[model samples]
Target: MEQQKLEKLLSKMTLDEKIGQLMQFAGHFYATNNNKDPVTGPDDLQVSSKSINYSGSVLGSAGAERNKEIQERYLAQSRMKIPLLFMADVINGFRTIFPIPLGLGASWDPMLVERAQTISAKEASSAGIHVTFAPMVDLVRDPRWGRVMESPGEDSFLNQEFAKASVRGFQGENLQADGERVAACVKHFVGYGAVEGGRDYNKVDLSERELRENYLPAFQAALEAGCELVMTAFNTIDSIPASGNQKLMREILRKEFDFDGVLISDYGAVEELIPHGVAADQKEAARKAMYAGVDIEMMSLCYENSLKELIGEGKVSVDLLDEAVLRILNLKNKLGLFENPYRGASIQKQNKYLFCPEHKEVAQEAAEKSCVLLKNNDVLPLRGGKIALIGPYADNPDILGEWSIFGKKEEAVTLKAGIAKHTSDYTYALGCPMYDRQETALTEAVNVARESTHIILALGEGSDRSGEGRSRSSITLPENQLELLRELKQIGKPITVVLFNGRPLDLMEVAELADGILEAWHPGSVGGTAIANLLFGKANPSGKLTMSFPRTTGQIPVYYNAYNTGRPLPEGSTERFYSRYIDTPNEPLYPFGFGLSYADFQYESLQLSANELKPGGSIDVQVLVKNQSDYSGEEIVQLYIRDLVGEVVRPVKELKAFQKVFIPANESKLVSFSITEEMLRYHHANLEFKSDPGEFKVLVGSSSTDLLSQSFYLK
Candidate 1:
């Protein structure tokens, strides 16, 4: 397990064995140790038996006895006894499902987010997982990108904090010290979130400045927090595929960032280089990936088939292949896999940790904090009324979002179950089909609505509608579900729309009809309980939106903190020549960091330590947040900075710092933030990350749209 031992093991590996270590395949490649023969083999890929035994890692594996069986089967067949590494897409949670990462971003409490991930690590490790592809820190400007749910949100600074938190939570203080921890792998290396037209695996074209200024920082933060691995994106960066882009994978990631950790290609990406027109054949693709510094090829045979030939010939060196093989072995050694191949993997651990009551409590609390209350009109906190819970998700329990591969959907609590906990004076109806109009279902729902004093319309995209390869051109509620709202609005009862979705939706129609709208974004296993608690007065909603909700699909990439154009449209402008939209407003329906709590928070008497700030000096900005309503709640006090003049054009406003404060009913809390010159620094035209001495404005507010402003000068 030590370095000397790892090197000795690496030195003994044959050419075929060393190449096998760099090739990754799905979980089906490994046969179980059970008495029955192996059901799936490497036949389709035409991989040999020796390579199957020596292959370094496995993907999409269900942990517990199944993993132990595979490890036992593999070790028995291995020549050097090198254990197989088990990695999974354990993203947010493994079995005890938490909110999607977007929902975690809405919480804005990284420590709380960290707690949830810690629970995820505990659960996942018990299932025999060694690594997780998580904390996807890509900056998303386009909500139409389905995988946007996997990212934290649009801001780089906030996502950086989440990135660090994810690394800390998953890797912990020492990954090898305890079997409970799994190494964190921050993925889609660079600019995968900004795909053309918000489509998955499409072209990712960005200027060097745009790439450095926005997308690269979060990955830097993740690595700085000691993320153990980097996964390449499927898309191309600078017209070169990220899996085979030498400048990005080799120079920037290796030399500049100095990430000595393992670099693995995304699923089947190394083979796709041929289709990308970057390579002529699989052999050429393997050569390019090795030259580009890819350590491992996931779900592909390009490396398995071509690497041996390339190394034998003069085209590629054995040294390049050795460096990658050693890295993979080093990871296995660090994970204690060399010491114990079935580390933390047992039926006993699974029974004790998976879906435990304590873990489920954290999942419930997280779901409660993650559900954002986007709009309210004094119709919330449903103070005792005959409630009509109508829609597709009423009794259905598939509220767990995508990437919840290990969670049992049947174990999830239904919305009806949560409502029963509050009161039985509620009628439940499946109002309409999820994607189509059902007139009979609609009439039943309307009739129930007529008898109820309040109508709760739970509607949004299906769980399958917004994960990997699930991009949507239209980002809004279907007319079938919207029809339920239209028919119920005629009854004119106080309507509260509960949305179950992954991405920020175009709520132009629902915003007009619903009196209250709560974004319960695929609120995981305890989603129903979380929603019901907020519906009644049991809990207060405190989640804020991290991504902007577009007014229409046309504003696909709409977000706060965008740079203004040369010819900017003035507020409330009717001018045609200025940069503005013809049919919709430039602003989103709901801006970032926007949420409402049952308790009203008022910002007053913003004060600054000094009117001028100098280099290496700090200024303390303070504001008093008072809760006016009787309900005690948590409020996110946001601090945004605007550079009035810069060497280059800056954003209208940039979020520098924020604090989540809890105020008792009718009490006040003084929220303070210290701003230093380093926080004001930006990447110049030449990519110099330093601050410029200029006038600046400090805006303190609850959300991006509503703010109280003050000014200062950096001298």
Candidate 2:
């Protein structure tokens, strides 16, 4: 009945109304060069304002009062009295901030991720936000890519689970029925993560097989989760930009996938097509983007100016205009905006839920689980030591990184504070600025490091250095910081390096110099407490790397799950054509699904209940994991599979399933994973998902690069 009403209303809408529906302008705010937008009101048109026309929707004008004011303006001033669809970049939080998505992924718990996003939606929707730009389901492989922190790591299956959970979390049971929930958008459709050289906004060129196999799964998973909106990528899929690629946005995303949701553009992505040289100008960029299926223009006025002229010149069809408007109206109707344009106007509720205690508790847990122990040499669990906490990030709260829109840095517990709470005597040195190259400052840092019993070197790229538009050609640690570490190592104290980077850095120096290294990738509000907990033996580090850490920027676009070339390497042979790199090893500094704990875990005795299985048959594969170390800690035992040969030439290995287990000192548990025929299936040459009857090797291990294996057969 609601669908019928939407259709009838859409059909009755005049060409101007349809065009108005298709057009979306930025709210009275702008993201400056620094990627931060200043808060503004609807009437504050000093920057640049639309002519009081109800262009289909508005973006970035969140908050209960702000959205209500915008809706009121739309209702009273517009010729057609249509309510505007309100959207905001509710990435991780609206009021209460959680750990970044990568940190949340470390928990390896989908339900937890869902709950966090659910809380985010509850807070966002209560504040008059009808839609959230969330579930950035880009399949990231490059750890150097700043936005890796925003994604659910590099695994397709894991990403699928998180994507689905996030959609359910955001939209709740149903948009129309759940008035407090907002519409969720799965973003950066089709290969935004595989940017060349791990640089943001770079090109992507992968075979179609790779795209369907690895890249597109999460996006499809989001759609399956009942997501009402899709945001196109800023990067190119093939030769064309994703925002303007009709084949991707129209032919595949719409025609083939049958996605009926409104396809919104990334922030200024439609306008960027002009700079991409595909579109001659902003007018052509707008025409191409709309024709390619972008329903809403985010932070770009190109659509508002170009759409009317394009339709008048017959450059764009009126039917497509109607379709775009209808989709927007359909989403608005589903969100119950027609019934209550100010549904989210609840200042009392916002005050209640924003930075709630329950949300902070969850954020702490997420932060704790997300702190990946990259390397430990019995230097951690710092129970009794005169520790020297040295770094610009040690006492600074701004190291919380980007997309933490609502997160108050002042509220963030600094590592210095957390350490002080845990230990009695500690000295903190500002050291060199995160990206600064000063040696005089390093002398003071070195003096402080030498005075302490142990030096805790907080290192890596600053928060401002690793987000979108903050891309760097060099991903190595700053020279001065590296020099400070080198000097600290000379002190001969047990040096523990705690990294507060937004993305993976080339930490070969710190990895070699530091006695212990903790990859604490900008864990959110409770990050300091979480790091302290892990350092003081209060909490175990169970977090794993979602993306591979590249040895160098040159060896980028690397992942554990990759296809074997025709010239396959024969084990134990150093042949030339067997898919080998002469200069560099075909491995990462740290592989995906990799992490460490204070305790050591030994995996032994791989047991399989059955060797052969059919489509419906099930097999139980078990491995005994013993905590050899004195410390009690948790370990995530990962399961992977490899088909020796296939019609499509499958990856050398693929992650199938995993289980995170906690073990007490000197205890063992038999971890088991059940496999069915569905788990073995994949897209064939015809792109159909089915498993072939063949021998398969099952690998069980702590990380992708370190595994123990056994064989099985599907018959």
Candidate 3:
């Protein structure tokens, strides 16, 4: 659609019709009779029939036939014959699922993450979805937040990289929205991940510097990558509900970030403004949301029923309505919906592409690269010995983590199934029930363990335990599962534990008992295949911890790169006055970037090109990485830099750059990084982003705790 045509079309819509453009209804709103006519009406809805008939968009995933029928009926009855935009939550994949976003973060390869989203776009677009609410891109440090499963991890720079990759993968090059791709929607605007107490939809209160320095960068990166849409958060930002926060949305997001895309409310957040105390009712909610720069009201009738009245009474500007409608129209046009409303949506395409082998291969590889080997005492690479596979997840294929909406658990292969392909000598039994100990089941598992030469135990939270409203006060393995492990430990056989969950968990007991541990964080779809291969030495665990694994649940929000406190605990000191926990250690159980590989890697001396970094010039930093083991493996070399003196107190060390390299057995590789003035920028107390002239430290390491360091000057 041309600019002139879109403007002219907008000029002709009535008040009711124009307001309808900003109103989105879920798919159930337009139930149709077999006669291809909508049998449902706006009787229950507060909006008039005209508004319901002219609703601009529908939310939900449906077959091509159903979407086509809905669009046909909608157009036939529309006064302007406008096409209805369809959107769905296709975060990981529509059907051919990959690992959850956090697991994708652990992969730490943005290009591979990009490929996964591209495949997600392909399958989702085939199902008549024009937009996907995905690539969460929120920076989460707390594992208690269920949607941490949706974030890349705690680091801002890594999240930024994944955010760009996710946006690019969904929209593709040139930002052309075609049948093969769905427009990407970067979500929850700002600071949804920093919700207090790690509770869902909790209030977010942060200083301007904290918000900008740590939280705002990733959203900026997504916008820079040309994300087409932004979703408002369900919680309050600076005490104002995000959908109704004018300073945050209109000033920060719309102006500061310069995002000119459509801004939609997350689910029913628009109406929830009343509960947030910012709106008196739905009408006030609509008024505040519109003024605050929300273009589309999702799953709510506020915009449908009250906008016309507000505009008529001069309480709200009709111009804002026009602006919102135009943005929606522009997005629909960008998606090429005007040219072919039913593009990329066909049962034929769905049958040919969904759950196809090529996509599953990608899923398998993603799973392989995403599983972190946390501990291995030479018990991995299981030999030709009889195996006992026991646990709730041993034969269960519900490994598809939460928010994998379109994926089917029955279609996924289980760890038992994957191991069976290698050998039938493995005996399997129940390692207790999922949440409790069944005496009979535990006895059976112990008997099987005694009969076998080794044990491959699978355990973790159920899929429902860590998504949306599923927050846990105690982030530990279920007591029964731990009891089962304690029982199996008496067998005195080497045990390898495969952890299947979404967020980082307290693994102290499991770590102590298991000879080896594979942190398989809900490797999706063909995750079983990846797990099986790694157990038998067919594949190597290359993934690292994007989020820190706490030693105990008390360290709920633990992360690397924290600020160096004034009374920082002395290294190896148990001083009482220092900032130390009385009971637990200060460090995480496994710090960020921590992982073990079958192949051993050694880091050589750190090298720097210069002692001082001058303005507009860059200093080259390098480290030699050597593989000592016989197996060839991929290594993610991470670079961290710390500002010794800043206008504001800086983090102890922040991840500035990283590279994923594959080295052959007994071979060495040089991992290099270039540090410019821009890389040294930080948010001061006044919120200015610039570097300070001072001493700095550069560190290269496999993880945050294990590092080789050197000092430099920036002038």
Candidate 4:
């Protein structure tokens, strides 16, 4: 009965009012000096539809005072007085920033990631923003792609966990009742991570099985977490643009998965479909997108200009328009905007929440957790050594990384500043500039390394090198950065390389040359302090790699959970038929879920309660972990599986579960994982998600590539 009442109310809406709900535009406004493409419009200027004379949804511009004013203006002019929905690309922070998504994923603590999102929602909502285009759950492996920093790493299970965490954190209990929560938008919808050659906005091609097996899980998890909105991808899937793919948006997302929330297009994605060769023009693009399932056209005027005309010309059905409007209205009603749209537009709260001290403290903690220690030698923790800090990123503040929407860079502590805080026994030098190969600079770096008792070479692709619209064909230390490192190595100094990249890179040289290497992939806000904490032994580095670090660019699609080939490689054979690379080892520079710490940790044994189980049975798998060194640290105990034989051949190794255990020095801890029939499932050729009764070998250890195996069976 309530559903019918809501439907009746939606049905009575005028065409103009219904159309108004479909438009969204950028909201950011600043001085001409700071704004990107600022708009200069008259008092009553109408950019598109007469109904949306006052924008339907505001993006970057509306905040607090502006939000209340805009809502008032829209309400007064409209017949139904519908309130405007405000959105922003509040990816990491509204005012208080957290570490980038990739960094948070490295922590492998979903609860921490959840809290970060919860904090983000709190800050964003306090400032009048209702939706955040966040929890970008793309399963990205290539570190060359700049946006990889914004993803939850390369593993499917880890990504799925983080996806659920972010959704729960952002949405809380209910969109209507939770005033602190904001709607979460699972973004870049379908396979934005598979951009060709790791370049942003490139094409993606993968079999349906591969897509479902790997890439699709994160998005599906977000949907399952009740994410209220899904933003379409900029990339094409099977040559069809996602913004206009009925098979993806309608068939898969809406009908199959039952995502009842609004399907919003990425910025200018609807219009870009024409250039993508999927649509003829803006009108056709808008028509196809509307029919496909996109409820809101974000930052693209295609809907405002073409949808009404398309409906009149029979290019689109009124039913489709009505359906889209209903979805939008439902979201608005769910947000409680219909009850009182100006709920979040509080100037006092906005002012108080923006850059609050507590928010900064949480941001600092997030940055600390995201720092992954890729390699650590006994020489670290500085204790009290004469250290030389060298590199462009060492003193740089902009290295807070991409999507740092509101992070105050000027206030960000640099590596030099952070190290200075720890100890006064430090000198500074600018090694070869990032992405530069000047011989004089290289010589200067060598001189500095030779002079200091210990050297910390801060290096990486600059902040601009990775993120959206940024993709690299070759993800290596640019220019002579590696050459400079090699030169520094010749100086016979114990060197610690601190990386500040946005994506994964081929760090083979650093792996071999540097005594200690840290993969600090652009930790945001308190990033410097976090790295400093690890360097000075204030915090034990426990974060692991979310993505695999390839040894070479040729290994583009490398990941740990890959399918086994019929002609599997023998341990000591050099046979050509085997699935092996002739020139390079198939192994990566570092495997996914791989990390190192100052303290040594050992995995003792894997013990399972039972070796056999029934269809609906479950068992507890336990592993004994001991911290052998004198220092305390954390270890991520990863669990993988091999089905040996299946109806369909499976990956030689598939990551099943993992736990991050923190143990004090000389302490032994037992890590237990519960396995069930559901955990044994695999997607069949027909895409039914279920398990086949079979013998399974569970491998538990430090990283995906390294482990100890134990056998189990399900009958």
Candidate 5:
């Protein structure tokens, strides 16, 4: 399918057919209803038989055989015989579920994350999925937002790196080349993660400088990596909905970033514009979306019903409609769907790829690396001791996080089952329900804890408590889980709390009650095995936290790299006039890049190759990391920089680069990082991106709070 052929096909399309190419709906719209009633879901978007016959694409449909049947039916009716493209929300995995994106972000291994996406692409393409709405590259700092689980973390640089990795992994080097690949759609285009009060679909208000500085970098990185599609956010940016903002879509994304990819609306966002008070009716909604550069209306009938009327009244131009349709045709041609309608979809390939043993091994490895040991008190590595596994998730298999549409919970191994393989001397007990207290369950849990030498208390939010539209005002453990912990503490046994959650929690109480805590954030299919290995000294935990765990819910947007205030509170100071909290400290309970290893690591002798750096020159900073304990483990050596004086106030510390290094027991390794002039650049008050001649401080350590510092000058 060449450009000339695509243009020729476009030239022959009728006005109705061209408009149909810009509409996407679910496959259920085309399904026959035995009652002969019109098919309707939660929304009032009616799908007529004519709309189904001419629809260009289908959403939320899988299975090679089923997709083939739908495509055949659609092509038989389409005047131009254009094949229907199948897309789904294949965020993490299709069948062989990997850890959630937040957990993968904790691994801090882009190459490993890329491999996981490659596996996701392989399984999804086999199941007849041509595109995935994934690699959500939103920079999140608020833990109250449930969608934070879908993001990488708080840093712009880390999110940018993972964004590029996801794009390369999904689309591969060449989309039309050999290997199982699906077109990647990097989503929530503009400041979706900065919703007011950390609520879903809330308003987002930020200056143009803040938008470009904090929000737009990761999206620009995704576009630079050659993502094929872009999805708009549901929220409003500066009082204008992102789906209908002409300046954001046309000027910044098109002219500035040069992204020529197809821009589609988030689920039913175009029709919701009327409620947003931006439009008076469906016809106005369709006009605004098309004029603002939204090429496709997802899960909505606004475009289907109003575009033709608007065009007839001379409100909308035929050329704008043709351009949108051309983008769709271009994407289909790029996917090679114009030639082979089936692409990589086949029942045979689905059987061979989905949940294969090799793919399972990668999931296991990812699960192992993603478990972060947040606190330890010499109570871990239950070697030859009778264990008590107690909680709702002790024997449950719903550990797979949200957005894993194709993964089966039954196939996932439970924690009790995995721990049983290590030792048969372990006992199990359901302490309580996920969110409620049960007296009989608590009594049985206490009896079991009294009979065991060590207790592994599994607790946290359920799978449905977080991710997309599941925001929480309080990010603490449930009262039942906390009460159970208090009751278990009186048994006088050493307890290790294993937390399975999607977002960072307020662990101040758990930090005091439990002897040890491990943040096992919704470890997927092989999660139980990975936890078992880490628990019984079979594997070492190396993951670091990407987001900050606050001391309380009041510190919603807490992160390590925050700007200094005019009146800053001194460390350990209780001055009332200074900027300090009376009830809680300004610092987080656990800082970003914070994690513990079985083997203790020590940082020593921070050295710099040069004391000064000139424009276009680089300086080498080196630090010696030693495994002080008699156990081998991996360490994430973090490098942070601070501009002591800047044209605009800078953060206290910003993570520039980090390296995950493996050190043998009682051995030392030298980790070196080259800092270039680009690393020192920042957006000035006037939005000028350049470096200033000033003194800079470099810090090297395992976490943001604990660091060894040195100074250098940038000239």
Candidate 6:
């Protein structure tokens, strides 16, 4: 189907049919005849079955047999026989679960992230999914928000790079390619990550400059990578909800960014405009969202009930309605759905692709790469010692994080099972429940620890504690788990802590109690196997933290790239008058790009090709990295820069580029990075993006806080 055919089909649609194309609902509404209870409708509104038959798309529907039935029923009723599109929230993986997005970000490998998405696309498309509301490119700095599990991390550059990789992974070279590919939808359009108090669906208030500087780059990166759709955020931007903000949707996204993709609202966001004090009724809500460039209403009744009335009263133009309908038709044509209504959906294909052996292999490799070693002593690599694995998460299979809607927990391997394959001289005990301390459980754990040579304490939040409407005010480990650690410390054995979580946690107490710590954040189905491999030296830990772990929860919004304040405190100063905390240090317990490997790495001898850079000229910065220990390993060499003087105040340090290299035992390798003028550009006070002529500092190191520095000038 071509553009001319799509336009011809659009011209033949009636007003009611066109309105139906813009409405989306769950598949259950049409799968069954009993509408006694409203299926996913707003509390005050009840959608008729007639509207379900005429709706253009369905959400949360899968399986080839089920989708084929619904499509046959819908096409028989639709006057134009337009096929219904299917969408779902395939965030990380569809059937074969991979590590959560946060864990994948810690790997610092965009190519691996892209490969995960490619597998995700293949599995989902075979199950009859056409679009996935995934690659959530929101930049999050707060760990209390449950949705942080879905984001990449705090840095703008890292999130921007992962955003492009996610788009290429999902959509591939073209959506109509032969492999399993679905259209990618970049979500939460503007500033949903900076909600006040780190609460979910809370109000977001920020300056225009702050919004452009930090939150908007990832979405821009997604659009530049050719994402086909955008989803509006649930929170308000500058006092106007994203679904009703004309300046944000029209000026910044449509005209400035030139994003001509279909814009859809977050779940039931259009109807909530009345409660937001921006609209008087459903009629007003539909009108405002349309004028703000929202092409489709998701799981809401405002558009179905009020759009026709608004058009009849001359309040809404027919041209605007046609424009929205045309975009939907054009996407359908692009997907080649007009020719093949089923779009390659078949039971044979679903069985052949979902949870296959090849998919499981990729999941295992991703789980291995995502494990980050935060601390280590000589107690690791338990080659011959008897081990004690004590915790509720030891034998539990609920390690899959939240938002994995289709994953089965029973299929996941347990930690006890993974370790049992390596050694038979291991004992297991359930120390306590995840959130509470039980006396009998602790007594048994102590007995097991007393008889063992080393203790591996596995601890973390429950699977339901993070992701989508599960925000927490405190990010510390549970008190009972800490108490368990305290009791186990009395046995006088080396303790290695393994954490299973969804977000960054304050580990001030855990760091003091344990000799070794590994952050294994919900490493999907093959999590236990990956942890076992890392524990026994079969694979070295190569992951680095993408988000900073604060020393305390009071330092809520902390990151590596923060602007320098005028009244900054001096280094190692404890002065009360300066900008320093009275009781705690002003730094994170674990900084961004911080991780430890079994092999020791040293950075030395920084050299620059030129001391000054002019227009159209590039400079090469080189550093030598060596593995001092007798074990081969991989290192992530990070490059950061700071503009000493600029038109606008810049951050203390900003990560510009990085390279992940492998070094043999006791061998040295030279890492080089090319610096161009494009990497130094920033948005000025007038919103113009350009670099200024000034002195800049170039820093090279393994982590943000520990660096070797040099100076150069940009002319």
Badly placed stretches (over 4 Å) of model 3 are: 32-50, 175-177
Model 6 C-alpha lDDT per residue in residues 1-715, reported as the tens digit of each score: 8788888998999999999999988766767634344444434446787788778888888888888888887888778999998988998898889999999999999999999999998888888888899889888999999999999899888999999999999999877645378899998988888888999999999888888888999999999999999999999998999999999999999998998888889989998899999999999999999999898898888889999999999888999899889988877777778888788578898899888989888888898888899999877766678899999788889888897887788888778889998999999999999998899999999999999999999999887989999899999999999999999999999999999999999999999989999999999988898899899988899999999999999987888898888888899988888777898988889999999999999999999999899899998999999899988999999999999988889999999999999999999999999888998988898978899988998999898887888888999
Rank by lDDT (best first):
5, 1, 6, 3, 4, 2
* Cα lDDT, model 6, residue 82: 94
Residues 1-715 of candidate 4: C-alpha lDDT, one tens digit per residue? 1557668877788776777788876553211112223343333223533434434677765467777776776676677666788888777776677777888888898998888888888878877789888889898877777789899888888889999999999999988888888999998889998887888888999788878888888999999989999999998888899998889999999988899998899888888999988888878898888888999887766887787799889888889988888887788888888787886667788777777788777777787777888876777777676887888788888766778776678877788888888888887878777766777776777776777899998988877888887778888887667777777788888999999888888888888988888888777777788789889989888888888989999987798887788787888788788899999888788888888887788988789999986767788899999899899887888998888777777888888898877899999999999888887787787878888877899999998877888999988
For all predicted structures, in order, the TM-scores are: 0.98, 0.92, 0.98, 0.94, 0.99, 0.98
In each prediction, how many residue pairs overlap at the backbone (N, C-alpha, C within less than 3 A)?
0, 0, 0, 7, 0, 0
Pitting candidate 3 against candidate 5, the one with the higher TM-score is 5
Kindly indicate the candidate among 1 and 2 with the higher lDDT: 1
- Model 6, position 54, has a per-residue lDDT of 74
Task: Kindly list the per-residue Cα lDDT of model 1 for residues 1-715, writing each as its tens digit.
Answer: 7789888888998988898889877787675323343334444554555566768898878768989988888888788898988999988798999999999999999998889889899888888889998879999998888899999999999999999999999999988888999999998998999999999999998998889888999999999999999999999998999999999988999999999999999898999999999999999999999999999899788888898899878788988998999889888888888788998787898899999999999999999999999888998899897999999878788788888999989989877899899999999989998899988999999999999999988898888999899888999888888888999999989999999999999899999999999999999998999999999979999999999999999987898999989999998998899989998889999999999999999999999999999877899999999999899999999999999988889999999999998899999999999989988989898889988998999999999988999999999
Clash-forming residue pairs, model 2: none
Q: Which residue segments of model 4 deviate by more than 4 Å?
A: 1-9, 28-46, 49-54, 437-447
Residue 147 CA displacement from its true place in model 4, Å = 1.9
Clashes of 4: 7
In candidate 5, what residue range of length 10 has the lowest lDDT sum?
33-42
TM-score result, candidate 3: 0.98
Encode model 2's per-residue lDDT on 1-715: one tens digit a residue.
Answer: 3778778887777776676676555665422211233334344422223333646677777777777866776677566566888788887776667777876776777787888888898888888888888989898877767788788888998899889989988999988788778899899887988888777888998878789988898899899888899998888877899999999989889988889998998877888998888998878998888879998877666776678888899998888787788788788888877887787668888888877888888877878888889888878778686888898778878646688776688888888887877887898888888777667678878888888898888876667876676667778988878878888888899999988877777777778998899887777777788889888989988888888888887787778888888676676666677787777677788889888887889999998898898667898999999999787877889999999878788888999898878899999999999888888888888888888999999999998978899889999
| Model 2: lDDT to the true structure | 0.81
Worst 10 residues of 4 by lDDT: 29-38
lDDT of 5 by residue, 1-715 (tens): 8788888999999888988999898877755422344556436656767777778888888898888878877777667988888889998789999999999999999998999999999999988889999889888889999999899999888899899999988999887774389999998988999999999999999888778877899999999999999999999998999999999999998889998889999999998899999999999999999988999899998989999999999999999998899899888878888888888889999999999999999999999999999988998777677899999889888889988879999999888888988999999999999998899999999999999999999998988989999999999999999999999999999999999999999999999999999999999998999999999879999999999999999987899888999999988999899987899999999999999989999999999999999878999999999999888999999999999998888999989999999999999999999999999888999999998998999999999998999999998
